[model samples]
Target: MSDTAARIADFIEPLRVAPGSKVRLGRDFDPRYRAGLKKREGVELLRTGVALLAEYQERLAAQDTYGVLLCLQALDAGGKDGTIRHVMSGVNPQGVKVSSFKVPSTEELDHDYLWRYARRLPSRGEIAIFNRSHYEEVLVVRVHPENLVRQKLPERARGKDVWERRYREINDWERYLTDNGFKVVKVFLNLSKEEQRVRFLKRIDLPEKNWKFSAADVRERRHWDAYQRAFSEMLSATSTPWAPWYVVPADRKWFARICTAAILAHTLMDIDPRYPEVSEEARNDLLAARQELEEEAPSGAAADPYAARTAEAKDEHGAGHGRPARKKHGRG
Candidate 1:
């Protein structure tokens, strides 16, 4: 890693949730933290990180051994879309799959909350991004406990032990994935209530952004405190070594993008994916194929197969032989 890369990695270290440590979302992390980087510098760093991430993605695709799952959770206007747009713009689209979870359908509701998300997990050699992930079940549903009744759980399953059990299930699930060659990266874009309000205002006031505004988004702001508490509890209980959470400060969109790109770049670098090695026989076969191709006549040369075939046909037909001279056709 270069000095800049090292600095970026160091800067994001504090954002990571330490395993088994209590996390107080509002008290521990500042929404406006910027590591003293100005907007221009942050954007430059973000571009660098994005370039490195693109390279890493290519390697991961070629290696085809492990997968990366990036889960992004946030409140309304928290910049999940923007982060995905900017950070992954340079990566090969074939190697990346993005799934945005919305209100579940009847079929999805019939299964466990995690079932739908599990179906979208990244395949080996691919990067999968969840715009709003399974965390919503704990955060949004917990804040609105009434939503659970619709899940049709038995009385026992709906008891006070539910949240704890879900937390354990989630941890175990992530550990299972990690043990089986998947790297899970969870990021929470921690934006402040005030910033969210400003963004909402922008959505309403700007014509181009008006399409993004929804009345439900404004109503959800009322449960900000509840969501924060739920998030804090979720982070505390489920941030395991196998799948850690990074609480990114998202007040400044540029800084958030840079931090997210840097973290992703670091994770991919740690995975250290590489192109698969070729056996000696495969290498020799490739060398022979290259030699055969090189020996072929270049396009437009006299030895070109198409050119030789055309000449042979002309001679066979005696088109160039002395005979009654054919009159040139004229435009009618």
Candidate 2:
């Protein structure tokens, strides 16, 4: 890694939630932290990280041994879409899959809460992005306990400790995935109340961004405090050694994108995926194929099909309709 990349990786170290460490969203992480980088510098760093990430992804795909799952959880107007777009812009689309989780469908509601998310996990050699992930079970469902009534849980299972139990289940699930060659990187876009308000207003005022605004977003904004508490608890409970949570400062979009891309690039470097090696026999076969190709008749000669057709046309049509004909020649 270059010095700049190394510095960026070091910068993101403090953003990761230490295993078993308790975190208060507002106090533990500052949403406006910019690592002293200006917008132009941050964007340049982000592009650099993304270029490195693209190389790492190609190796991961060729190796086909490990997969990466990036889970993004945030409040409304928290910049999840923007983060995914910018951070992953340089990666090969064939190796990445993005899934946005919204309200559960009727079929999804019938199953356990984690079922839908489990089905979306990354396959080997792929990167899967979760826009709003399984953490919603703890965030949204915790904030609005009434939403759990439709889950068809046993009455006794809806006790005050339900969120705690769910947290444990999620941790265990993530650990299991890690053990099975899937690494999870969970990120929370920590947007401040004032910043979110400004972004929401932008959505309303900008003609092209009007579609992003919704009355539901305003209703959810009212429970920001509750959501923050839930996020704090979730981060504390599930930030394990295997699947660490990154609390990215999202007030400045450029800074946040740089942080996220740097973290992901560092993770991929740590995984150290490599292209699969070819065996001696396969190498010999490739050499043989190359010799055969080199021994073939030179291109544009009579042995070449397209060349033969052109020669026949020249012989029949006298080379050109409007120009003088030239003497026939062998391949140059």
Candidate 3:
């Protein structure tokens, strides 16, 4: 790796934290967001990493022994959607699936908080993406507090303890998934509040993007500091070696996407998937099938063997005829 690439890798490494540890989230870690990547260099790195990830996606699918769970978390307008779009554009859609979590359905609320997420787990040899995942329960609910009452945990524990317990539960659940066969990669698109305000305004001012805006977004913005605290705490509590969070600086959209793609490609490379080996008998059978298809006679009205014969005979007899005929026309 080049020095820049090496530094990027090292920066992402600390994001792989163990459960119960503390993590700091924000531009404090990456002060040079916009200055770090100019457009051309950023796009080049993003394209390169995405291409590698596309290959890794196919390899991971072929392996059939490991699956990747990519979770994306970010404040609104932090470029989570853009990261998924640009960074993962090269991956084959058949092997990759994206799940966008909104407010839980009544049925989901009835079950364990992790039930919906567990059901969406990637099958063997697949990549499953969570747009906004179970982390919301701890983050949003931790900030809003009132949201916890809806979860119906034991009445006695429905306070700060509830969020803490959920954190422990999530950590244990993730550990279980990792031990079983899942490679989890969580990314928090860390955009500055100023950038977020600009994006929100863009959505409101542009008629095409107006639908994405809502009064609720303003409500959430009021609790920005609270949400940040919750996010930091959640990251610290749930981040593990097996499933680490990458805090990608989102102010520069291309930079964030490239970093996220590189992280996933690196993770998938570790799985080491390859094409299945064929036996001698299988190879022979394949060759026989090919030969049979090639030797098959044309049938029904579609058969036109005489066409080939006519063309061959005409070519042998009339090689010079067309040239002379064309010369006479030109002379005339």
Tell me the tens digit of each residue's lDDT in model 2 across 163-210.
Answer: 889999999999999999999999999999999999999999999999
The regions of model 3 sitting more than 4 angstroms off are 1-11, 14-21, 26-28, 31-35, 293-332
- Each prediction's RMSD to truth: 11.6, 9.2, 8.5
TM-score of each model, in listed order: 0.88, 0.88, 0.82
Span of 10 residues, lowest total lDDT, candidate 2? 299-308
Ranking by lDDT: 1, 2, 3
Give the Cα lDDT of each candidate.
0.90, 0.90, 0.79
Report the error of model 3 at residue 173, Å. Answer: 1.0
Instruction: Judging by lDDT, tell me the better candidate of 1 and 3.
Output: 1
